[model samples]
Target: MNTSIPLAASDAAATSPTTLIYWFRNDLRLDDNPGLLKACQKANNLLLVYCHDVAAWQMTRWEVPRTSRHRQQFLASTLADLAMQLKSHDSRLLEVEGPPAELLPALARAIGATTIYCEEIAAPEEQEEVAALRAAGLTVETVWQSSLLDPTDLPFALDDLPDVFTSFRTTVERHHVLPPPPLARPQKIPALPPAYAALVEKWGATKGAISSGFADAEPIEHQASNSVTYRTGGRSSFPYFLPLFSGGASAASEHLHQYFDRKLAHTYKLTRNGITGVDYSTKFSPWLASGAMSARQSYAVLKEFEAAHGANDSTYWIWFELLWRDYFRLLHLKYGPQLYRAQGLTSLPQPSHDARAFDAWCQARTGESFVDAGMAELSITGYVSNRLRQVVASYLIHDMGCDWRAGAAWFEAQLIDYDVYSNQGNWLYIAGRGTDPRNGRRFNIQKQAHDYDPDGAYRRLWSAQ
Candidate 1:
């Protein structure tokens, strides 16, 4: 599901409205959401549900919490904003906790829902969730909405997708493929059935009320036991503590428009790699990752800015980065579960794990200033510059001699903008397990520090804590 669907009112599903559920996964915004739009058209009365997967709160094999407080706080804010928008549209959101397989089916049976609609996520775990729902006797229809370019518009079949990103990018540009224009926010959201609303209320759950106990400060695994104080000095590159940077559609929209109004995209390529600033990079990943913003929405605005102000190499580079995101996603569709293999698509041997070194790296005590600074920023701020992400990731894999999967798991647990496709793809690329012709990427930390942080400002910025 790597394409945009133009949902039409005259479609077969819209012939007559039926009782259905709309499960909000990664695509959270009401704008340009083909899946949700279809649900709005096809549903007589829809139950808009978002499930907080229990596994996200539990510990991983690395003995770290599956998610950090920073990620949860941003998520809470995103869900809160989404609920508000839904409310203004005469609809509401139901926040439930538990696996979608268990919670959704019970709700459907309880409310007599005929179908469930959601955006298609091509990753293995997300695919499994959809399968589990069907196994439990529910019909789920997923629309592809994440990728910028539609799969049908691609010049090559997915199986023939280039193994290298440069080739993929060049081919896409040569063909002039473009994203479907972003759709407007839905004017109306169908009201919830009285019976369905009563049933959930009787169960002691209402809009904005959790159906399960998922508090923001739930006890974590090792980080809690060690009395680790998760705090930042408010100097983060992408600080979520501030209201302007808060999660959800409103902030995302404000940030998006202001970014262009300030004409930041003109210098995006030059400043995107800066280590210590708020506006150095686009900082859209947090919203983009949380589904609070859509990639198409961002691109449409970029094009609008270009139309008014004109385009340049910097503006072109912005789209280049977007293509990289789409490449990771299309890779999932082409290779499927192979991308999750320990050796990835290559025949490389298993990566060895060094628990002690890995733990030191996670705690920001790796004895390497550059890597430690980056790791510290990630742990406390849940956000790091893209350059530092590559640097710290390379250090953990090639220098610390740890399993790449452990590093990926730690990132999944900590990073607020963690996308399954990008996290896994980047780790595999750095570990030499993926389709890299060079096999692996090993950064010279000293040179990187000199090139990116010549005055040691970034290192000192994170050192005091």
Candidate 2:
């Protein structure tokens, strides 16, 4: 029942040389990566490379920078882990800070690599980079490893995709196009070229820039000055949801095993909306967003759980959420440029933009106490409850009438688990221009605040002024 796919003949041929390059992008892990596996199968020698595009960090149409420190910290941790993993396979991840378009191909040439293997990204900038690499005459092979459902196996073509999520979901479910099982980690990694040592040394001296667009109250001061304990990166992140589940892939796998084996899937429907603590929701999004876990792996575990424990509404709901994730990703692939436009996809009523109002929202100085608190929480912790995300997004689009793109950009800059598809899709949905049939369905801000935070506990924690 595995659905994993390998590269095409031409792509395989490109990697048939003595040395091949595996460029790590969003698919950061050593496990279940088709591109990495394929590269391992084809090459006798391999060079792993990661590029931090400085231009991407600095370029901003909105006020915020693209890569926030929170995301950078997470990425840095993951890269460190990835390097360790690669070392076991006899390869090392070469970290570089430059545009991939120029740097990747140049690095490939420098190391005498005939082929490049990497994950495929549908974003505009990534697509341009791919084109640039092809134009440079290197054999570039891309594996579609990002989504739960492969686009080629989708029920309908991208252009003909249903505008509504339910329609897309129904059609896919009816077609029964289940995702393939996750790929296993490759057993042996190829050796690096002798010259790669020099390239690695050159990149080692480059330091990552810290941007103010995504700063926080300094961590040391937060702990010492206020007697407040904050969970920093690494293993501490999952512990915050203590007594529920562990963090990282090993923890995620164990949680999946227990949920299926112990019939916890049956209870998910009852607890998914709970406001506080770990068991409330799956807590899989952060891991899934970063490629630490794969949608297919989660699905396989759920299916096994259902087979053993019996399927029910709770089991179905997990798939429902995963399908929603897939639907949003497809929407991104389908709309492409339109999704990035100021007006979004729908020809609906537009919001009024006032710089002063927008500035207030960004600065967490908005007059509404609840929305202001949520914004501040987002600024300081890089994490927000799903309830608050919808509430704050509604407040930004409906009450303040700010441009949705601005708000989406702010989330992109702030969220630690910001996936381009989910961030943009959710924003467009709130703005009434995405998959929603009813355009601009605004949430009742006051009612939501009262219902979700009746005692104002969340507000008290985050309200700056």
| Best by the lDDT measure | 1
> What stretches of model 2 exceed 4 Å from their correct place?
1-17, 205-264, 348-351
**Looking at model 2, how many pairs of residues clash?**
3
Q: Tell me how far the alpha carbon of residue 339 in candidate 1 is from the true structure, in angstroms, after superposition.
A: 1.0
TM-score of 1: 0.92
Q: What overall lDDT, based on C-alpha atoms, would model 2 receive against the true structure? A: 0.74
TM-score of each: 0.92, 0.86
- Model 2 TM-score, 2 decimals: 0.86
Please give the CA lDDT of all the candidate structures: 0.85, 0.74
Lowest summed lDDT across 10 adjacent residues in model 2 is found at 217-226
Q: How many Å off is the CA of 341 in candidate 2? A: 1.0
Predicted candidate 1 versus true structure: per-residue lDDT over 43-157, tens digit per residue: 7788899988877877778877777777876887898899899988988888776789888898888878858999999988899999999999899999999888889899999
